[model samples]
Target: MADVACEISARGFLNSLLREWTGWSLAPAAEAEMEAGPGDGRLRIPLPSRGSVVEIAVVHRSSVGLHVFRLPFREHRAGAPARIMAFAEFAAAVAHEPAIVGPEAARAAPAFLGRVFQSLSAIEDALARAPAPGLGLHADPSFQEAERALRFGHAVHPTPRSRDGFTPEDARTFAPEYGRGFPLRWWSAAPDAIVQGTSRAETAADLSAGLAAEDPALDRRIPAAAEGRVLLPMHPWQAARLTLDPAVDALFRSSQLIDHGSGGSPWFATTSLRSLYAPHARVMLKHSLSLRLTNSLRLIKPVECARGLAVDALLQGSVGAAIAARWPRFHILGEPGYLALRGADGAVLPQTIVALRDNPFRGSGQRPAAVLAALCEIDPDGRGSALADTILRIAEREGGGAQGAETVALRWFGSFLDLVVGPLLGMQCAFGLLFGAHQQNLVLGLDDGWPAEAFFRDCQGTGFVREFLPVLAEAAPGLDLGSGHRFTAAEAARIMAYYLIVNSVFAVIGAIAIAGLAREAVLIRQLRRFVEALAGTDLPDKTCLRLLLDAPTLGSKGNFMICFRNINENTDVTDPLAHYAGLPNPLAVAPAEVRP
Candidate 1:
């Protein structure tokens, strides 16, 4: 009993002190063998659930044995006890709650004893297998000379300590709305905060109200309160580094969506607030894609988004910049942009990722017609002007410079095709449609109320199968699919399905959705007209051609619809002319692979 208490007390001190300060928790106790003998043993306590497993080794001085405490994965899956408490604070808490140790604990201890002893058996087995002294060129160590020993390996470990190194100067300031739940160091009297719900509305409201009543100098009006909704301001550098302009900053300060859309509810439709600062500060505020239309969708995880943004910022700043010279309106913001946030855990929030838009798209409303008119008004003579030069270059290089509308469409399609199948595919499996032809990813350069240039934005949404696997492995190495460092082919296939069917397809759908909501017929009419013009004289099916040409409509493959599109066998096999027949897709399931 004395030995058990001593072991437990030593472990309890570490768990209740050092580990707690470092945001670590003690797993249920486990048994470990100290040496090959039956009496040599101790208990081990595991750290809390983190990306990696950290074990606390406790040695039983008398028994000279070791036991490891590990919460069974099954138990963790079932219900593991976890508390984010401070060491000093929680020690006081435990002292006050002595009832925490009870008959239930006694019962739990015996179960842990069985597990600990089992582990000790394995340790003893290992020690027994150690090589005899003088087995190799050198004899065992001085200490090992008294006993048989095996080769030794080295390891590194961090000593557990408090996260108290965080100071007021290190305090990362964020807008009140985004401040909840984030760890912060403050000089003020009242600074501790915890988010009770995932709703941005509730969090923002509480934060705004709290700040207004507390701080007098700071202007609360920065957060626009519309329909009881507040736009929460967040720091950009922590999770992602997206570039933006002053206009985007102002947009972040002034914009507010009707806060009903839940976090990561992919289908939740709401307004978008964009501000860019690539060339100059340009702000765009629009009400669209909110809870009414978007509740069914799932947003990608934030870590996944961070990876994409890093890739984009790196690529666009280098190789992409060289090619982007032709598309002058496509701008890259040089610094990170602020964000509005709402979500639980590390989930992606339904917030804008601001960047500099040198020339912004006039969303499907009034400004589009002007852009279209500008495209038409360009000099037909094909001399001077960058636009004409590009068109001529396309004519000379691609399809024998097919003239008129055919030449333009062919050039556009050919450029898009080359980008996707070439550079885009070379990276890894990516998500967003390689070319977000829709207004969402596209912007028109305006020269005197006319569209003189066209560009694509949201490059971060672009994805590759190869780029993601390493990141995924780093986060969870067990998920690695063998074949060394690269992702297994099976993993690649899954990513391909997600990229093509979910990300790319849905982007197209979003474009279409924006189009369908047109208050004026001009947007749709001009689109149809452009399609007709592009398809002139070519006897291709106009419906199919329009479907392929119209950017927004082509991009709308959202989640639910993707499940339907993901059918196994072309059940229409009997219809001899089924679309799936001889479709050379590697992802296509052989009739044999399908479930019987």
Candidate 2:
């Protein structure tokens, strides 16, 4: 716990807090807002109950919500010196402002603030630690190195690092910022008690057993459990937490599931925290965590595991080949197999679910792959980002100075638009497949900081357009992903636009702008042109593209509301719209130019 008075990155913290605060209001809102004040580069936000207003000095502003403000936020009264307030004080006042949160923010304030403090402390810790792999040493940095570089977490999100269920020590040991790795705790389950699924002919048992054999420690202990037992690998944290559950204990007593103790080549935590990666291992393991991080429980449900296998099926069929041939630079990181244990009543245990994801970075073949979120994140210390560094490095290599740098940034962003946006839009318009192409899930294979290929992961967030079901069926007969995977054209439009345009593409624009490489509107203009060129093509379901080009407002994730309402995005299956709020479209504001 941090003292409310104790602060780290006060200006940066306040900027992020207020950004999320007013940004939420830009969409359909409960109360908080920023009123443009007399064209003086100031934002005047009123606190109705307190009868005072907060004034912020805008430095770098964006038509989108990515505004950077000058320090020392002043609270103005009817007759006061505009009292300068601390970040915590400002956060507290905003939280209690009923006009903004309708009294709900007051109740949720402490839980939210406590997590914010934890996140801030984590950032401070990350800043002090040296780059784990000696980052610049490797010509092509490992995938884990890029994952570790996301010290600040989500760009527009508050409490990006608050691991609610973790202790400070646990946060240091398990969180990606710390660059921690641990041996997995092994387990063996009777084949009857194990529920398994795979896209290929190989059984989960066969995969797990083969992986276990690679680890001599687990390999030696496996035979003792039983000759016919199925082996499973679990995160040390998940294994420890699950061992405390009564149901798990009961199963242990009955010999249905036996613990083989901890052993394996050490696996490091990735940006997602719950997902573990090992360079030597053939697969990355995505474990089900009970803790709430961000808007959802990190636990993997059977449905989510099933979704990954379905993706593998799609990738194996003609549909996959066509998508591959169309967008050679795009990749899908699908889970080939998954394993979970069943309870006494034959119910799947959520905590026991483990997903085996394909690891291209395995062995000596590690690539300079990083999620877009990491590359775009601004250093709270005002040192810019890995992306900025990459752009500048490229500029230097090409014998360029200050003016030349902007040109490099522009060209770099254009490649990103091609490699990322092209395939994502193609997936939507042509195939009627919608990927959760959020920044964190979209990893770019970088060549000297230039995006070369797109690797989209987490198949759980995928959706199929019902209108294109017949097309999908004919092309990929292997995709029978069942209910919830199918969505109406309207639902697909909202999801595709929100994920591809709002979350993923917008982050790149923000990064380039925030780094001072280019103006926000300039990048927005380029984006508009990119969309214009794509929409000119012959693809079906141009709804998302049209919305990008014409919609006054688009749907955005209401991160503030989700935290205040205590909604779990993963489990909130009924009202998926709860995650959405209205966001002013930057494309609407950026002036479009007449092209020859």
Candidate 3:
């Protein structure tokens, strides 16, 4: 395993620890004041348990609150000579310190540290088999290839790459970064056991034929399975897990469920480990899993499945058609259907659930629609990212030989504002529909190196602004917006501002800065202009815009808090919003500017 890869992961973890303590007001008055950038010096953090301080050097600062730090954290104790501590020790120290994470949260530290080590091991394992990040920089890769490109996971996450309930071999075979593919495990379920909601012309049975086509050998055998039942496909790892469940075994013996074993084309795991993709498949299959990934268990909830159908129905109605008419180039990858098994006891099996998402990049309709998270991730070699390489190429070729990278970056930033950012805000402004367009949820389609269009996915995350309910009711009379899909204006603005601007756009800005292509201040100024441009328009909802322009801070999901407390995100119903915390707003400080 490459030690440098481990070192990068280690540095990122510590940087996140410092960012949380500093940005979230967890650190004390002294420890939270460390500035980032060249010549800013190192940050010394106290390890209360060991009675020592770990000093980390600040190499670069992100305008989005997370800073890049130098590794090899040195532990300084009172009388003894200073010695270097490894990443494991650092993780333990953070858990041991109540001031860093609250006393209640510190109790969950041991569980947190276990996952941290698992994440490091997973990173090392993936790096062994995965292609070098430098390779993806130049190539116009396939959608699946781009999906496999995230070497270092979430930009600011503490345990970004960890996998729970995964053996090293299972991880290698199933994780996206490993770039491995295996056929799906299929189970045939009786009609009574199937619970399905579809907006597609083809049912799950029809889609199963598509999967069968990918493997000619399985095509003939599926006729028997497809005769009178729905063929449910599962992620191979999830299938092995369900095999051990007594509930699943009972169904198999009772003839309500029949195992079809592993068949069809080998679908590669995407960045979201539970979601699988085959190049020629008609739909992207998202199977439910019992495993915990990051902050949530991978089980697919019934309410989420219901939301996908509801959003699809809404898009097919008046509101969607109106939005499409205004932004002709804008698109949403509609999830037409979801299927799950219902136990004989009449309860939905979360593990048996699968969501069928529209696949615009699969088969004949394929294009270079790159997931923004994968594009913005720091390359494994630590040179830069795929975003850096692509943006630099745009500058070099499209800058007309006179303008520099920064100038081209400014122009490119403007186009991005129009293509991706504008419609996203416009959807909320005019229609009250909020897509959870975080880096992982949104994809950008490139045209000769420039962003030409955007695709938003994850229909289950769609939200309606409560203030605009009357307007929505009038526009789409019979539209079923779903039960808990509504958010108050303040709630909508806070979460939308974070996902769209802070989490998504800031990462794009940071990618440029981290690549040494341009300063973040310049891009922040351009972003300010983009918001001003919106100010020039007559938006239906300005609450979100107002937050971006005026608020001193925007709400951000605290990954550190979630990890420290061992919170299961999907299962948290009563206080799911409690994980959100305020992040220092960079735009509030940027000198406002507008250009015609």
Off by over 4 Å in 3: 23-40, 78-80, 213-217, 381-383, 398-403, 590-596
- lDDT against true structure, model 1: 0.26
| Top-scoring candidate (TM-score) | 3
Higher-lDDT candidate among 1 and 3? Answer: 3
The stretch of ten residues in a row with the least summed lDDT in candidate 3 is 23-32
| CA lDDT of every candidate | 0.26, 0.75, 0.76
Show pairs that collide, candidate 2: 27-582, 31-99, 31-100, 32-100
Question: How would you encode candidate 2's per-residue C-alpha lDDT over 14-113 as one tens digit per residue?
Answer: 4345534562222111122243332226656788888888766555556666665554567879976768876667767877888876778767878877
Any residue pairs clashing in model 3, and if so which? Answer: none
- Deviation in Å, model 2, residue 210 alpha carbon: 1.8
Q: What is the TM-score of each candidate against the true structure?
A: 0.28, 0.91, 0.93
Q: What is the per-residue lDDT of model 3 for residues 1-596, given as tens digits with 9 covering 90 to 100?
A: 65665676766676466545762212232443443224335667776667877876655556576565655667889899878777677778777787788777456878988888888887887777777645235655567877888877877778888778888988778888888889888788888888887765777656765566565546567657566888887777888888788777888889988888887778898888888888777789888988888888989888888778777877888888988898877799888888787777888888888888888887745787788898888765454788878777766666544347767667767888898889989898878888998999888888766777788888887888998888877776776665437888778888889789878998888777777777788788778778877977998778888889889877777787787788888877455457666777877774743211
Q: After superposition, how far is residue 213 of candidate 1 from its true place, in Å?
A: 22
RMSD of each: 29.5, 4.3, 3.4
- Alpha-carbon lDDT of model 2: 0.75
Ranking by lDDT: 3, 2, 1
Ranking by TM-score: 3, 2, 1
Worst 10 residues of 2 by lDDT: 23-32
